[model samples]
Target: MENDFEGRPSSEEAAASLRDLGADRQALADGVQVPKMLLAALGGVAAWWVAGAAGANPGENYEPPTSGWLGLVAALVIAHLIRRETGIRFRKMGPRAALVMAAIPVLCLILFSISLGLGSFGARWAVLLTSLSAFGLVTWLAGIAFRSALDQLRR
Candidate 1:
């Protein structure tokens, strides 16, 4: 109030304030580091889910994999841990991040289906490859998505 000229800031002052805010956002985004444990946990969960296919019976009388539910629970726990570790809760991680996140589950499902096929053919050993693939792919994609989310915060 003491510094008010005409009960409001000048246009230049407003612009400068906005620039400062942007810089602050950028700094906050830059300071955020993705937790390695979060990535590994997610990757492990994905691998476990895909590996479940190796023991599943594909045809009639096939029982749904109980591992799916366990994996979902693990994922939820990871999400909570990530929030606590990061100290930032992202409201929206941007379109690219969203797409990458979506792709994770889709990729896992594809690998799981392939694993099921291999199991049906008695090639259960091949599921290990799919499980490893899921681990690597999920971890990489999760990193990408986290970076993209930070970029959104910078904006």
Candidate 2:
């Protein structure tokens, strides 16, 4: 006699079929999604930090609070865009990329400090312009680097 379950697939088999049809290997391996709230909160914190940095009066003449805010916003936007374009999580980008990304901000900070040392203009304005230009350049370079790295990884 034939068993009642002879024609029926096991639950595991059905689940495997659904997974094959609906999900990619990568999706199953490492789930990824836009971290919107985290990004927004990071932007807000950067804005607040820039405001405080601007207020510190580093003994220069070009005191512009908005400049600091703009630079901070630009960096945050760049980081957010990078995260969106790459499925690679920030933590998973490896120490090398993390080191490079970290260095970009530190270099910007160093430039700002040097600009302030020049003492030709308001410290705030000098720092803001220096930071914005440096960060912008670094962000552009980083986009290229990330694309290249992703290409290499795909192979």
Candidate 3:
């Protein structure tokens, strides 16, 4: 038996279809090659999702990042599965990307003031702020690195 789609194609072949990977049905109906609106909308949604997950939560959690860790992990797992099933291009994520991804959650967790930890509401708030700042810095660096990596791949 012959399968039309034999798993993921090589980088060259994948690159050719990258523009249409995340496209919407409207573009397909319109017989367009590119999906500008879909790409923009997805980008905006992705940014908002990341920021919300990374930002502070409303619950007075005894654990700082614990409340969001499960949600974040779940989202990541779901995304991975969806991408695989949908035949999206899966890029090579090196140590740098893994480190940055892990850092986001761990950095936030560092602010957690346990029983023997930084002892006080005020100090906890301070730690929270510091954690947010550090997370922002790492995220900024990650954005640059991610963009550069994509540019290289595209080129």
Candidate 4:
């Protein structure tokens, strides 16, 4: 006689299917890669924002650094480009990635503040150090965050 569940998958078949699905997820995760150029652009923008403090007039005639606004816009554009290039919009990048992402701005702000202080003291040349710091730190952190995101996908 024919079995009532003839059309249904057996337990072993179900397990195999699940294993294939897991392997597919792993393959997709491995295939996803962030573009290096975008990360460099992000670093450049971060450096520019911090470097803006060099030309800023602090104290008495403090003309607020307008480069900050421009930098924000540039950053947004770069982020859009990155998303478009990657095509993987992560809903949750895990806590490590989140922390690293959060740290980028904080680090930039610190560097900007330092630049402002140096500029105020007529140490305009020092802004270069801060700008370089911004570039290095931002680029490094961005890479870490991307790796963390990839790690999340592996799970």
Index of the highest-lDDT prediction: 1
Over 65-119, each residue of candidate 2 has an lDDT whose tens digit, in order, gives 5666666776567566656654554335445556665765566556555655644
33 Cα displacement, candidate 2 (Å): 19
Cα miss at 36, model 3 (Å)?
A: 16
Model 4 lDDT-worst window of ten: 1-10
Candidate 3 backbone collisions, by pair = none
| Range of the 10 consecutive residues with the lowest summed lDDT in candidate 2 | 146-155
Stretches off by above 4 angstroms in model 4 are: 1-6
What are the candidates' C-alpha RMSDs?
2.3, 9.1, 11.0, 4.0
Q: Which candidate order results from sorting by TM-score in descending order?
A: 1, 4, 2, 3
Stronger candidate by TM-score (1 vs 2): 1
Maximum-TM-score candidate: 1
Task: Answer with 1 or 4, whichever has the higher lDDT.
Answer: 1
Q: How many Å off is the CA of 65 in candidate 4?
A: 1.2
- Over the stretch 59-121, how does candidate 1's per-residue lDDT look in tens digits? 999888999999999999998999899999999999999999999999999999999999999
- Higher-scoring candidate on TM-score, 1 or 4: 1
- lDDT of each candidate versus the true structure: 0.94, 0.52, 0.44, 0.89
Instruction: Give the TM-score (vs. native) of candidate 4.
Output: 0.90
Ranking by lDDT: 1, 4, 2, 3
